[model samples]
Target: MKNIKLIIIGVLITLSSGCSPELESVNFEEISPAIFPQSEDDIEALVAAAYYPLRGAWWDGFHTTSERGVMFINDATTEILMGDFSVQLYATFHSFEPIHESVTRFYDDFYNKISANTLSIDLIENSSANENVKKIGIAEIKCARALLSYELFDMYGPLVVAPLELLKTPLNEVPLARLSNDEMVSFIEQDLLDAAEDLLPPSETNYGRFSQGMARMLLIRLYLHQKRWADVEEQANLIMAMNHYDLESDYVGLWDTQAPVDSNEVIWAIPADYAGTSENQWQLMVLPSNYPVRGGWGTIQSSWKFYDSFEADDIRKTNLIAEYVGTDGVTYNRSNPGTNMQYGPIPLKIAEDAARNTGITTVDIIVYRYADVLLSKAEAIANKNGVPSQEAIDLVNIVRNRAQLDDLLLADYADIDTFNTMILLERSHEYWCENGQYRADLIRHGKFSEYNIDLTGAASETAAHKTVYPFSLDRISEGKGEFLQNPGYN
Candidate 1:
């Protein structure tokens, strides 16, 4: 597996920096679709390459738990995280503009992977490998492309997806416009659907690789974003019927240093190691610079408002450190917030790795899990029926029960609006620092601006137009009047 991963990384490097034709004396075996990926191992490597950008690497990986990745950026946009840095303030207070580097970072960094995956799929299809290999390879690549596209689309509305034919030619100078909203949704939906047919089931798939459940989970999320309540319920039900997943018995145990990568609850997790292809730096991101266990950069914090919102006895809240003694012999807490506590509690979602001397750890970054499916079904059922159902309430209680909270009564959440509010809050508490989908949840419920305004008092900066972020100024310039920016931005 390590050899395959290294080969994939090599493929990415070769793609980025092609062999120089100027060195004519040195014969170069140029890698291209026409010649490479002819063997089974080659096809496997190509598929693995499609999965590379989604790893936890700081430079380009999209799912790193740290500030550079989607989890931090998305969580920062909500009350889940706050910071003193310019980019953190921009995200937390909704003060982002077209020129803000952080606002444009995701798209600028990973958009090329869409075409890269497309090229991989094309190569695998044309290879002389067996039909089964080709089928599986194509499915994995499609899933990777869809996952990458969905993340980008969730932030920036549609994207300019270049065709494989166009990608094959260099210096073509053909500019493209972003897809229509429906077109973009259909494009991603079709890819996921296709991938789900060939992906291995959860019981058969490796921990970090994409599976049938992962593909369906992505569908559930996309449907939730589109407000297709019936579709969400259907997809969530399909996953539930897989009978291969369940919530972890202990809520906090999920993030322990020895947490199982193949936990029944985790649908998809990026496997990380301190020395490797992927890394998890959550401790470093939230821990104080003088923290006794492991000194960290203290880059971001959870808001006090968010901390106080949790039920006192909730086991999930145990991970959120409210007070701790620093290496300087100073206690940091809400009352005596030296430098870190003022922002809020340390949002240490993962347990402290005392043995580690570096920023990265072996903690696998959980993306989609079974609890999200249950809550999503609950939300979908209520919305689809126009009222909270007994089944819906039960689904939610399953997750709440794991948190050691009492079951919520159906009568308490009578209407769709009331039920949705409860669901949103439940989601916020359950998945805050996990994958950063709470921001999308707030936006889907039309509370993005309102919640931020109430939490941060940034009334002037919070608005409906800020629901989808603006395209970067550089992208707009490159569009040459062809690519229009998202609404409400110049």
Candidate 2:
């Protein structure tokens, strides 16, 4: 676990060759504050490449030195420990156990590049480039930096507050110690806010650069965490005003590879070029034997809780899951086990044919989908005066309409408690496990204490203070105490 800090605060060096015959001619100097712009396009391309890891795939997917694979262990708890035993490594990560090991490494790997990204702004400025290119390069780096922090803070921050015993031995390292849940929240918020100022507007960044829409989405995310109701409303409204995005006629279009970027409700998205550079989320999420065999390397399975959240009345349930065609050659699932086809909502949100990990394809995640913005509006309205407004009901209904549903009933709630609960259920039905957004959402609504209902048996056995994970002892060993442990895990 000592390397946890090393991972979190990753280094940026020439991709290592292990057997180095190093040259000293390339000067390593401080980044100058000069503003230049020639490298802007290069910066944009780099940002596009960075988005791959977030999808839980390979290449831009999970890097081994990092805890990217460890998350597989953590997510498995929701499935293997809680669901069917079809996958083993899945449940091994229950809570902090698997998480501690992988995340520490991931932190180092992620930060190393991100920290280097900061220096990128200065390099292009100093390079023989124009002003627009340099400025844009810096902006892209800012966005990259925010994305990296968001990933870490998303998984470990609140969940694993520290001063933890930290991992010691290679095998049995973690022990426990203080709480810094709120502190973690602040650190994450600060990064997003700083980045938003420098990010390019979604329209300007073009195909794969950070845009205003991304910034706006991030703002809403930060505000939600702080319980800054009005600010959430403000940012969401500004984004909505852009009028650039509209819900796709078919909700499932968001995941279609044939679909163009920003054609539907997507405000900002990564363009996974299955053609050149590629990735397949199916490799990480689909079943082993699915057609073409999504790399036959299924790691992250969908949770029944996530699937069941949809009311049979909601159309999203059908469109979101795979069209289960079993050995019988059916396009849909059989209602009963005896039937030829059996299906329980696999990740249709990823590429269909790419369901095999071995396939060459890339699937973009909808970072700031239109529906998400609408929902943020709904949350803001409902959180006002500790009571939901009719405005809140309107927001929910807009999404419901897009989902092919009728009116929502939240407007009738007599008080804030009922209204708040109603909004959460709405959020659940709309955004569970989509982008690993659920964990942060749970905390936003102030239910972090009560919400991690991980049926993965180990969560039940954990110490009450076991919420925040301990720092990786590997990090401590490498970092020499530069990074502190999370609460209670030492």
Candidate 3:
């Protein structure tokens, strides 16, 4: 696993640098499958390469490839965050523009990763390796592919669920039509279920590796998106039964840069080198201009509405720094967005590391946490019977209590509608920039549009077609009329 991490780091650096012509000149015949996978290390290396794209989705610092910008994409587009409108050229916040570079790059790179994952699976499955390696390796790669597919589906609806057998087929013979939205969901669910069989439970696998916990956690999110309330509840319970994960007792320390890497709260986290080998670039995007540590680009900050949404005494409010004394002895008020270099409520959840001026930090990018399971189970149960159950209220209180806030009783909420609204709000506070789950949360509650947000030119309600984003113009051009772009873009 350490070797795999080193390989990932090396690959990212090479990718961040210019391409190599010498590397390109090497013939495909020199690296055919027959010669590779002769050893376990070789197989692991192949699997590691498949996961390389996951890091590219958020880190690597490249303008076109770094998905770290997704932090801006998810938050700025919603009502919870704000940046300079002039600087918000990506259009995820201002308007749903199909030509946005980040959207196109994100879409293209994810598909590229899916292709890499498929090829990795083909190589491992066909190799004469130990059966256990084949099983677990293939399972992990499949889960990785499923994760990428889920994100793609979330962003762009009804994309091609590329056939596994196509791994063996020539590109010229491959078909590229997309699955129906329902078919795509089923395909992803089936893939995750199949993956769960061979994976160890959470914390049993290597650091940064996928596990049964991640599989079921993802399934819970999938079911929630589909409004499969019963399934969501069942999946969350299944994860709890695993008994390998629980919330970190110290809610504030969980986000601390120096927190333990093995915190029980984290079900799955993408590892980064605190020593600066590999890093999460989010701090570079979110920290204010004059923060105590190394400071950052100050591109994104919390919206005043989001800052005010928290309870006055809630410890989670520590995630938002309303005012702070800078190293330069200037007292900054983050509540005012109009002043020069001033943006409302800075998201200090991801702290800055003073050691590196490059904006890279040791913070692990978390994908799944046990607290989310609790909150999700709460929401699912409340919706199960169209009324907030005692169990639902108790589950929510578990999260709230951890945040040093008082518990809520069933009487606090007037009806199921009100309870559901609070649950979504709780999720916004707890999981802010963790996994991009908040977007799905908003869409699930039917609040993902201008109806809830205050964009200047937003339509009265979000168009049904706008729920899923449009296909990039490059992808459409590459398909050359074979692919159908999402509705409203054309």
Candidate 4:
């Protein structure tokens, strides 16, 4: 919270942070103990700080940070997105090592976020705010914590989660120890469950704030990762029953800044400002370096295999562009299919921007969408029943139909194995590079190793026990044996 600004605006307090250093500590004098806000607006500002890390900055010319960092590892390591020319961090992820700065930064940034949110929770609880305000504030903080912890766990497996009181203490004064996977998962689940109790339902909650549906969505994803099939099914169904969210009919238009605010498709979206400094930076990373709309570095591209995987009629393929009209009145078509270390098809999911030339794009980055819930339901049901149930088939078909693909029938699949595979492939296409869901989906389907089957250069034999990221040497040395690296890295 060192650089965090708790601005008291109209209805809600605007909270924003910049370059959140790992050792950063809040100056209590700003939000003084004597005169902190007792109103809901102030409380909302305090809670909003928890989401700052998700809207990562373009530090180092759109270098990997925040959601981009997560997507970098998730997509680059897999086949959906490939790097171009960049060498040190982003390019190396496809063949990542334990020493990679990207992994370390991701580890550090997320922990700082967890710490920041923890501080917010404690401060909110101790404040003289209304009891109802305290409840909601605390609930939102817990949800934020849960989301951050889940991201860490998804990347690093298990972690040393610092408690609120300990985080308040100077970093040097407290010793951190990694939680066992089960311990971490239990902690995450408890936070989500508690947050759900106080959080408003999706429709009632302000846009971008944590809600009951988001809590359930997180629980569903967590359960899916843990192979808690029954829990996944239960949580997914619970979110579906919220009756507030649904897949947007316009697949390409869903990411539009002008898209309806009440879009039932988005469960949780990190809203970016249209004109201010808070604009989304995603367009610069995935858009072609020469594309006229919002010329990007042309760095992140879809794999040819990925581009080929789509059915001919799938609308998503069109969204994954191979050609585009630039502001220069020049038509650009991708012909050079560079190696994994270079270019391929560009992801145009966040491509349509009216303000691309202005250095900041106003596109709202979708964190969690209803389409995922539907697909997760399909996967969960298939897993729970040990077969492709008709319900599961219908759910998968719902997504495929939206993409204008032919309807999938349970009869098309011979057994649960093939059916589950199809659902995962569907997820890969539907959610590619959309906040790193592609990587998580791969691990869940046990297809992670399939990508590792071929290797060369610095990545040879890299897939061995490398499904999870390694703790940076810096983190482990700092731990002095208290923090253990993921087993394979050392």
Candidate 5:
């Protein structure tokens, strides 16, 4: 891992310091493709470069698992996280506009990665490496690109994805418009499908590298968003048929410092370490500044409305701290709530890393899990059937049972609305703070604006157009009127 990081760093430096003085005067007789990617290691490093943006690094990583990351931003927009930070306040109230830095950062920082992946794919394909190496390398890069695209698309609709030809001519002033919805979906769907053909199964792949399971999982999510019920069911069942994943019996154990990176439940987790390439700073995001075990900025907290939605016996809620003794020798809870607890409970999802002297911990940042596949399958089944199905009920029970909760009876959910409500709630309880998909789930069910208004009266500002965030004002201005902002933002 360290070697891969080093190789990526070297590549970045070379790319950034274009036309070095040492090479400027010396023209090569032949710039042969054979000279580069001559071995599997070269291809591996290129693949690692594509994975860099998705890492848990604090500065530029899109999936950092911290305040600057997708999980925090997306979860904050939902009921899962509430706080006084500008981003949190804006997201929580759905009042974010095109100029808001936090809301626009994902697009501004990482959208170019789409072209980066395209360039990498072109490089790997044109390299003199063997077919097998090229196949695997291209597949990994495609998957990484597709995953990033999906996240961006979910948050801010279709993007102006520049093609490889356009990327090649850096000086060209070719302004492009965002892809239409169908074109955008097809673009991402095709990449995942093509990549899955060569991606290794979960059992065969490295812990953090993109795998066939991850590709399929992304497909399921895409299908879910499109409400393509049968498609969701098919893709989810494909993963299940691989028999490469299952739920971790102990819910909280999945997030422990000692948790296995190769757990059956985790379809994909970013392997994090305090030292380097990837870092998981979730512990520092929610823990209060004066907490006894560890101190954090206390940037965000889970709402009581969300906390109360969980059943008392649900082990998933165990990590939520309703009260805690501070290092200042003060006890705090909902009633005597200190600064942190004023909004709600401290959502310390991952176990506290007591040995850590820094903000980051060694806990793997889980992205896709087998539990999501199961729940997604259940949702697809119920929605496809247009009512509660025993199959769907059983699937939901599998997850609930892991949470140490009683099975929900099918008869109880007579209609699709009730069943969907239950499914949404179950999703909220099960996957909160993990990937921030709960907000997407709400929007999918046509309840994003309504739910926020019900939970926080101030969210009355939310509207249908707010479902997808606006393109940043700078991006629109840069487009020279060729690119248009998402509707209603104007």
Candidate 6:
């Protein structure tokens, strides 16, 4: 079973890295920047590093709802998996620890390229390069910086200082500084703002490059998270007005091989293809199986909590889970609705395709999309105004209409608390597999301990510093100068 899943996982990895092709090489002499000016070739090498790897652990490793359970930091899994010993004093909350520990590799990886990008930007600003190349290069840096900072913030949170001046200051001299969350967010906002102005408007050639619309989409997300209602609504309207993309009619087909790129739903996705080792989302996804029935590899399974929330009417419920009978005739289900006495449940969010005969298996992992923008706008409206405000309810209805889910009541029989609670459920139901937000959704709503029946063993936490992940000791040892080890880790 392991080997079967391994092979399937291999196919996934192969597709992701563009199936690296054997190549011929050209010879050139390398010279120091002090001796000779930077050339387009030199700039390309540096930016390529940042461009190559974009997935942070959270972004890629714990990407799906089924696998993303660890990030939620609750006791449900412990109760189910470790029934008797959950209250043990040794249990901890390391998920909240800062990410600078394990993430230094990505920083080193991208910052080196960012250094080169900075040089390229300087050349563009001062030198006699073509206007198009200069604009493109500037846009590229902004795009690259946005990607890096987004990764950084999600993992490490805001530090107290700015990150850019540390760009080329040499490893030893860099001081450890933490940007406040507000400061970190401000910097990220600035990067997208710069990109919006520097980028070409959306079109074909720019399809491969950053565009104004992408920047705006990014801004839309930032505003949503920051609770900026008006800005979120405005940006969403702007993108929708442009009409470049439409939601894929078939929800299942959004992941299907023939899923057309016709819709404006996607703003940016990590470019993936079925030819390489470095880029497959499936490498980490497929569960191994050996029976005559549809084979599957069970690396991670869905939470009973998540599966229970899905209504019978929602199409997304089908997309998020798969039910199967094992070779042993065991019904595989964890979230078996307490009513079902037998069986286990696997993630239906991604499957081994209906047509496996073609060997066409590459999955496009979405980073952000338009539906999120609308939700963000709706949430923002609710945050700024009360839950029943027409605009907030209306925006929420748009999403409900698309998903065919029920809407908030027109009459104000219940208070805002009731409406807000409904909104949270809708967001959870609709966006479960889209982002690593399901578990966080549980935490935000304070419900992991409730639905989780098997929550007793390691679910108990005795550690003093038990909210987040700890910065690994190894990261500091790897020349991460001045970076503080997160409070709870070591």
The prediction achieving the highest lDDT against the true structure is: 5
The CA-based lDDT of model 3 is what? 0.68
| Reference-based lDDT, residue 202, model 1 | 92
Number of backbone collisions per candidate = 0, 65, 2, 0, 0, 56
Report the Cα lDDT for residue 254, model 3. Answer: 65
Instruction: Return whichever of 2 and 6 wins on lDDT.
Output: 2
The CA lDDT of each predicted structure is: 0.83, 0.51, 0.68, 0.69, 0.83, 0.47
Question: Which pairs clash inside model 1?
Answer: none
Candidate 5 TM-score, C-alpha based? 0.93
Candidate 3: C-alpha RMSD after superposition: 5.6
Summarize candidate 4's per-residue lDDT along 33-70 as a digit string, tens digits: 45665767667666656665555455421223223466
**What TM-scores do the predictions have?**
0.94, 0.74, 0.87, 0.87, 0.93, 0.73
Task: Write one digit per residue (lDDT tens) for candidate 5, span 287-312.
Answer: 98999998998999999999899999
Q: What TM-score would candidate 4 get against the native?
A: 0.87
The candidates, ranked best first by lDDT, are 5, 1, 4, 3, 2, 6
**Candidate 2 residue-wise lDDT, 1-490, digit = tens:** 2222322212232211111112111112232224322344444433333343443334434422112443343333332112233322323232454344443555544544443443443445466665665555555555655666656655456322222122112243342222255665565566556556666656555554467777678778767766788898998888877767667777665666664554647765545445433333443444435433333333334545556666777766653453455434545442542221232445445446543334444555455576888888887877756777778888888888877888867547757777666667676566433554554565565654453444334444344443334555655455454445665656
306-382: candidate 1 lDDT, tens digit per residue: 99999988888897899999888988899999888797999998878888979888877888899999999999989
Q: Model 3 TM-score?
A: 0.87
Clashing pairs in 5: none
Candidate 4, residue 114: how far the Cα is off, in Å: 1.2
Better of 1 and 6 by lDDT: 1
Kindly report which residue stretches of model 5 are placed more than 4 angstroms away from their true locations once superposed.
1-34
Per-residue C-alpha lDDT of model 6 across residues 342-375, encoded as one tens digit per residue: 2223444544554542222445555566667666
